[model samples]
Target: MPAVKPDLETADAVAKPILIRAGVALIFGLTTVFVQEPSTLWMKVAFALYLVFSGSAMWEYLRREPVPVAMRSPLSMAAAAWMLGTIVLLFLSAPQAIGLTVAAALAVGGVAELVAWFGHRRAFLPARDQLITGLAGLGSGVALALGSHLNPHGQLGIVGGGAIIIGTLLAVSGVGMALDVRKARNLEADRAPGRVD
Candidate 1:
């Protein structure tokens, strides 16, 4: 039997959250790229903003949407990690803290996303996008951890670059999901009774 296409409602539910994530990531990435040679204070502020904003977005979505039971924990875990990282940054001002905090947040979020992808591997969610994003976050986190001795600039670059790459991937995934919804609607219309081919 052929695979069934997801209904518009189901696809939209999944796509909206992914698009929100993509927006947050792209904005953070752009900020890092434009801010040249950021001072320790600037990096601290930027990182804090990124974590809180991203976490808030996820938190709001979870409260508003009836996410599947299997997926809810991982998403909530990621949001919690971001919030925790923000709190940690508020107390630590050292340059090294930036790398450590960013690494921890990414690793936690990455693991959560990977878990969600594994659980939903056969479902309607965009598993491929989730897999790639998880990998990117995990890989970047590992790299930052290993480069703990590097200057703040080096640490910022690694995390910022990862954000840009993941943001781009999610942007593409979001657009693809939106297009799929439109195409599915068109196909349904064509197949309806009394409709012209």
Candidate 2:
């Protein structure tokens, strides 16, 4: 028997959550880069909220994959742990500590992606997505490390700038996806038996 394909509406509905996440990230990134000198309390609260939101999105993204339980479960757990550690370090107002924590988390996640790509090459779709994401994570880790060491006080701007760029990219991608979904829906409707286009 052939595999049943999902309808256009179903596909669009499934993608809605991811689109929302991308929008949220884009907004947060844009807003974060503008705060010249956030107070310790503000940093703690902001980081806490960011971790919760981003961590949930990451978990959901990974969980939606068709990878093995062992791999996905451990990755989900690592993502959660990374968020918790980063939140704690941010709350302590330790820039270097936070940077190191983020660096380590990114590095670990990146390596795991590479390993997963190699281990389950057939199961993984989107040819180079895993590799690209992994490399980007590693690169961001290095940048964060350098920023923390060179200018702890200026790290906020560095982080903010990075967030802005990332957020903008995500927002654009989300908008593109939304357009694609709309187009698919329209095409489907046009093909309906009684529809007059």
lDDT, model 1: 0.78
Candidate 2 off by > 4 Å = 1-14, 63-78, 113-132, 149-153
lDDT of 2 by residue, 29-146 (tens): 5556666667645554554554466567667656553435555654565466557755666546565666666556655655665665565556534213445544555565567677
> Candidate 2 — which pairs collide?
none
Residue 120: error of model 1 in Å?
1.4
Quick one: best lDDT, which candidate? 1
Over 4 Å off, model 1: 1-5, 60-66, 183-197
Ten residues in a row with the worst lDDT in model 1? 1-10
Q: Report, for every candidate in turn, its global Cα lDDT versus the true structure.
A: 0.78, 0.54
Native-to-model Cα distance after best TM-score fit, residue 148 in candidate 2, in Å: 2.6
The sequence of per-residue lDDT tens digits that candidate 1 reaches over residues 75-162 is 7898899899999998988887677887899889889879978887677356556688888888888898887667767777777788
Model 2: residue 67 alpha-carbon error in angstroms: 7.1
RMSD of 1: 3.1
Candidate 2's error at 10, in angstroms? 9.0
